[model samples]
Target: MMETSKGNTSPLKVQLVYTTNIQDPNVYSEVQEQRESPAPPKTSAAAQLDELMAHLSEMQATVAVKADISKRHLPDKQDHEASLDSMLGGLEQELQDLGIATVPKGHCASCRKPIAGKMIHALGQSWHPEHFVCTHCKEEIGPSPFFERSGLAYCPKDYHQLFSPRCAYCAAPILDKVLTAMNQTWHPEHFFCSHCGEVFGEEGFHEKDKKPYCRKDFLAMFSPKCGGCNLPVLENYLSAMDNVWHPECFVCGDCFSSFSTGSFFELDGRPFCELHYHHRRGTLCYGCGQPITGRCISAMGHRFHPEHFVCAFCLTQLSKGIFREQNDKTYCQSCFNKLFSL
Candidate 1:
């Protein structure tokens, strides 16, 4: 008879019975055996390497599948972020168009108060519509034309009064038309000669000391007059003896010769060249009877050359000291005493 038993710890169990024919048939021997299943043959290193390679190939395929999935979805993620940014930008623009953007609150430049509701932007500042007014007149000005000067706003009337060109003569503002002369502005009707107080025509005029004058008035009032011709010296005049004269008129009073470029002398407000002056006014020497053109000595209404005036008897030059006169002749005091004294 044979029997088998199996359990969790033991893999296989077998019981065997054997009968001896020579002995007692009835007597039987029992044998029991337990055996575990044998393990398979040890594998080679090459086989182990091949198995590792197969596992690695499977892992690589799985990683490649994950990468492909990520690559396909990356564009969608970026597009979603970009769309969110664009939507935010559109919302901002819409807010601005509706005047609800997060703009900083401004203050009125004129009143220095917080500006609310409607505002006027000008002169690099913000102001309430009603607060922006003309600085000069202190009147509200907006939507209408205005002017600015020195960082202050003004209306047209006040602007013109404060800044417009003025007449040089009257010192009044010239609004409509202006005439510029002598580096100054004037009203057309006010542009006139300062001397005659007459308005200048299209003809030429002159300026002196920043005052305008007509040609005729300028010549008569300011031009130098020739002493000889008694006419206004237009040009090419000579100045002598504190008087001005035309070149042709400046001649010798005696010879009437032009002293255009020569030395002259003035006698009784008349010009005389050197030759004529000397010849006409030269005194005759009493001793030599010749014209005393050089240094001379005069005594008793008579002129004598310095070298010729000598003592009558001694014949010495009478250079200094008092001399005596007799019969229209001069003698030294010593000679006179020697000749007359007893």
Candidate 2:
């Protein structure tokens, strides 16, 4: 067919536009015509509008598909991010909780320190961290709460104890226990063991075996011991003064400072030996500067030592050394020589 382009000497022809491959002879010929054609008629406004509408419709379909894809992917992405955030938040909270303190202050008795687990003391009583205790006997009085409520820290049973008292020794305030202890009270460890004839670390008051044994009794390997007197202890029954004593006993009355080698001297209604003993006296001697070992040396008249007279010329000591009395005034040798020369 002859194609016609604009008034530019082109054959007038209708070349069909195509997308798929043209296999038919007619379709191939149409492509060849389109190739030869130099120009085509200017599309009318209606025709242009129709073409623009077709493109707009295709674009709209493509935009709808993209929006659907975005909608499907956006929700999933947001949910995943939120789940991760929640897990991170939980882990952070777990870490913070793990660091919480297990013990609180004012829970420990002696040291007033924090206590995490259970701790039971010797007295068989439950106690808090800050509580009164006896330093001498290691007796725990009570929790700080009772003291906080009332001014006292111990019960009256603790006052008159003859031996070790922990709370009193530590100087903590006595509840009623210290007062009672001062009267007739004794700790559980105060009873004397009849076997060893020695006071045990603890006591059993009502225990009237009359033959009481202490921890030492259980620890003793062999040999039965006396329940009344210790080995070498003498027994006496003089009215209310029935007390047993050892022949070689040298224990101190003041600080338990024992005397050794075994000796005795009568002093203040008690036997005291020279060893493990000391005496106090006032007067001092000018010669030795110590309390006289009980006597003094003196210079009298012409029988005086040289130390008792000064040299006639030098006016110094006459030099018979110390503890001496010569003719008159005590004088050193140098002074005596000067006096003799004069």
Candidate 3:
């Protein structure tokens, strides 16, 4: 019997204890006494304690789960923070290159636009923080607050012109050149022929010899391509207003002789007509690299290949001797002293 708080029962009652028969009179009497005392019985103590322990375990488990969730989310937060730092570092370098004396506070100087948080360039030299000016321009310098983004300081004027000296390449007294940035300069006449080092004044295409270089050179000298013609001359290419010659094409522009038919050579950066350039290896005296083939000297005398050495004093044929090894300048002992005296 439990008491009802609905104004319908007494405060003291025996809950879960009923009077069956008059079997256990002593037990019945004890229940009645406990109802009078209005307290729980001794047998119910362990049950109440067990219920409390169950509630405590549930609370502990809930807290442990919450802690685990926080631990899992921490690394994601750290990664986001790292990405922000990297972005900021890159912007700082750009600001330095612009030669900005100070960091802009709000609006852009050149475009006169509001700078958003994401698009705000740290490189600008003019900006406004307190006022919403549609344009950023230099006014009277007021005693206002300033800040340095990288090494640059800013107040309110355009400081892009305060950077460095002009570029040496295209900064000319003439008006044809254009300066893209304060540093990058270029001339308007840069697209002419790269071979003759000639500034092509007209718009006509030109070619010479069999190695077509230019029309001017072909008529002046005998025209014909090199022994190794049109082969994307990697070492050099054709050049010449006097005649057609590969940049690497060492055919004589005067004699129509091939000089470097299958070898390497620097483009002479000059006008080489077809008949003048000569490239002859077998006929050339290997000693001084002069022609001696059909004229007389055998290829195997105290024969010095172009790559061999000869003594200046006695004309002694010297192999790769100790003294000849350096630049292969083979000098007899006497010639060495005579040359070194100077």
Candidate 4:
């Protein structure tokens, strides 16, 4: 009546050998002869039980006949007759008890036949020693570990082959630990960076093309290069002028200094500080030789700040495009007409 758990794979050992009383007169002599001449090991316990049951059946009939004869012959011997009757009754009861106890415990779950000796107790059922077989191959799963799914037993090899999750990279069954990522299952060791072929650590990983990659390889292969430093931007980047730049890499083109005001001017698609941008564009004021950030006047083929553009004779501010150029010096209409009129 022993039951093994689903996880337990140890073989269930049941001793089916039954012993009879040696004090019985008829069986005592035969048992003595058996002890004197030992039987071979090849004689199975079931075979021995069958032989003993046959002998007991024969002895039961002989004792019945002997009791009948004693009842008729020893009617005058009361004391001896009572003792003999009690002994015969006790022996008969013992034999009946032995027959009941020797019956098989339960039917085999596989074959639906009574399991006699060495029954296997597994999956909350009894099975014959050879009947406890894998449901798939029908081969005996004797003593070895097995997997049970949906009330069916399977050997270790077949179970893993049929049901275990497969590794996405190696395409092999994952027997022990399974690592799941990117909608695929894998073995822990097989779940490595596709670029470097090394296992991922605490830094974790990145997914590209449905494969895992380390941070360094992923950035190098996929991340955009910085517009200033010309290196891959890992994170925290600025997007301007259709180019990406790492926060530290977004610097002025000439001075290589980061923008303090977070403002930049672009020339030929490159960012520069205000001073450098105006200098590069040749837009510096002619009078002050500095960049003109506000409105400026262009006269005498040179750009001049509005306040700096003056009439040469009157020293007053000349309007934009309303001055006369003479000797490479600018003058207003009235001043030019009055000073140089002939």
Candidate 5:
């Protein structure tokens, strides 16, 4: 007879031993012994054995249930006889006949629950059909295209609104190729002149007032106008009279000649050479009928060259403020008193 010890136990204990018959090993007899303890047995040995057997049966049933569930979760083995389609068609029904339920193939990415029915595979994860929804709108994304950002799924409309670059002109999302200029974004077709609305070419564009423009419109609308030609002064321009003029356009308004001496006089908001400027304002000498560019004498209501101011009677040259006037003519003081001493 072989005896086995059950490690450690409480002070009060009942030891149960079962020995197999030598002739028939399957037949067994039970021997019960009560050890020295502070407490007596509460019930008979037969009743305690019955309770233990019932508990063992319950544990065994629980283990069987868990094993069945594990078996159903395992990956399916390759079927040599039937194709995949046939096996899938009858597999659920066959399991149901065996009183076993079908298990979920995957868990939903959104709700983190088993996907027993239709499943949506998106963004490298599986999801229940109803649970696969846009993060912003919370609307279902079943069978439709989606966008992914920051490990989250979104519908097409929300994705474009939230993430796509917007056109600076139209204020709409730039779904296609983007043209970035003027520190803003725009669609390729919408990146045009703000004034003319004509599209820009590879020559590039200009910016003004926080908007973009083609070369033609930019110069026409923003560049200063030439003072002479009254047209846009694109380059090589000069600023005069608070206006800009191209080098070729800066000419005399009257004679249409350029200032050879790099100097000009202004008349009525226009530039002119010294000769034409004096003539325009009637500042020329009455004797020579030429522009008096230097100091001149005013007598008889007409400007005169210094030597041209002479006496009407003796033809003597007169000094300024010492000359006398009579009958709209100029004369010296001595000649005036000699001719007509009144």
Candidate 6:
């Protein structure tokens, strides 16, 4: 019979039930003893499960710590890489400054061959100090004062000779200081006034006949003179009968009146008004026997008015179209044909 105690659980007894005995007896006994005893007060299944969960949590914590350490080292590794890159960049710039070209090494600009030793950096290329020579005069211009024009180097003296302005009067190069006027350049000592043989230095001048002249000489020598007043005709004047005269001095010879604006006749080298000239020197009209005041037609040593110089038979104007003259009498073609065609 099984015994039971009050409020106390009894140990379970496991019976060894065997079917076959092919194995060793000691092995079978050891297995039966392990099953029969109360497992020597072993921990419960739930406690063992809790212990396994704690071990799993500890392993997870260890893995998390390792991950955090790796994450902290990642930035340092990146910074180290960036520092290496910066160092490399600085080295490259230094190499460039030392004239070590980043591309394939090129030849010297002047010598047209591979550059070996010390080189100069100029004109967007490399060159040897001895090879980089001036284009003009063929002199070496290494680290010396020089000028560049049209992509070619030139020494100072040769550059000035090639580009400096030339004098207009002497036709010599203007080396130091220059005077510019009349759209030309001249040396300070070579610039002179045209009228007077005097040197002009920073003074006002005038140009005439493609020559420079001082103000006083230009006004006195080249200024026009009036024919009537015999004075300098500086500004507005009248030109008539091959003579220049002031506006106030232009007068009629016969009437002695000022002619503002009208037709004037020249007689005996004198200017006369229109009315007085017609009365004094105009020809007489043959038809009216009066002085011709306007245009007159002269034929056969006689002058006639334009309206009176017509066909006598037809009384038609003969100034235009064809006409015939008989016994000094003008006749139209129709009147002449009707009277004399037969």
Error of 3 at 188 (Å): 7.5
Kindly report which residue stretches of model 5 are placed more than 4 angstroms away from their true locations once superposed.
Answer: 1-104, 110-118, 293-295, 310-342
Q: In model 5, where is the ten-residue run with the lowest total lDDT? A: 20-29
Cα lDDT tens digits, model 4, 231-281, are 898769899989899888788889988889989899988889988999888
What's the residue-level lDDT of 5 in candidate 4? 20
Off by over 4 Å in 1: 1-133, 140-145, 148-153, 201-204, 259-265, 273-342
Candidate no. 1 TM-score? 0.41
lDDT of 5 by residue, 96-192 (tens): 4533345565787876765555556666667776887888999987756677787787888998999989988889998879988888898888877
Q: Give the TM-score of candidate 6.
A: 0.38
lDDT tens digits, residue span 153-267, model 1: 7777888888889888789888788888888898988888888888888796898877789999999888999999888999788788888989889889998998666877777
What C-alpha lDDT values do all the predictions have?
0.68, 0.38, 0.39, 0.73, 0.70, 0.66
Q: Which 10-residue window of candidate 4 scores lowest in summed lDDT? A: 24-33
Tens digits of per-residue lDDT for model 3 on 128-160? 333312122444222232323344444323332
lDDT of 6 by residue, 203-291 (tens): 67878889988877887788787878777788899898788898878888777898766767778877877666765664767766666
* Full candidate order by TM-score, most accurate first: 4, 5, 1, 6, 2, 3
lDDT of 2 by residue, 1-342 (tens): 222222222232233322222221111111122466454455574465445446546755665565556566656876755554454454335433533112221245454443333332323222342344533344554321111112223323333243234452244433344322333333333434556656655453222333345554533523232222334222432111133454334344444444465444344544443432333222333323444343333443223233323444555554543422245445456555555545
The superposed Cα distance between candidate 2 and the true structure at residue 258, in angstroms, equals 2.1
lDDT of 4 at 201: 97
Q: Which candidate is the best by TM-score?
A: 4
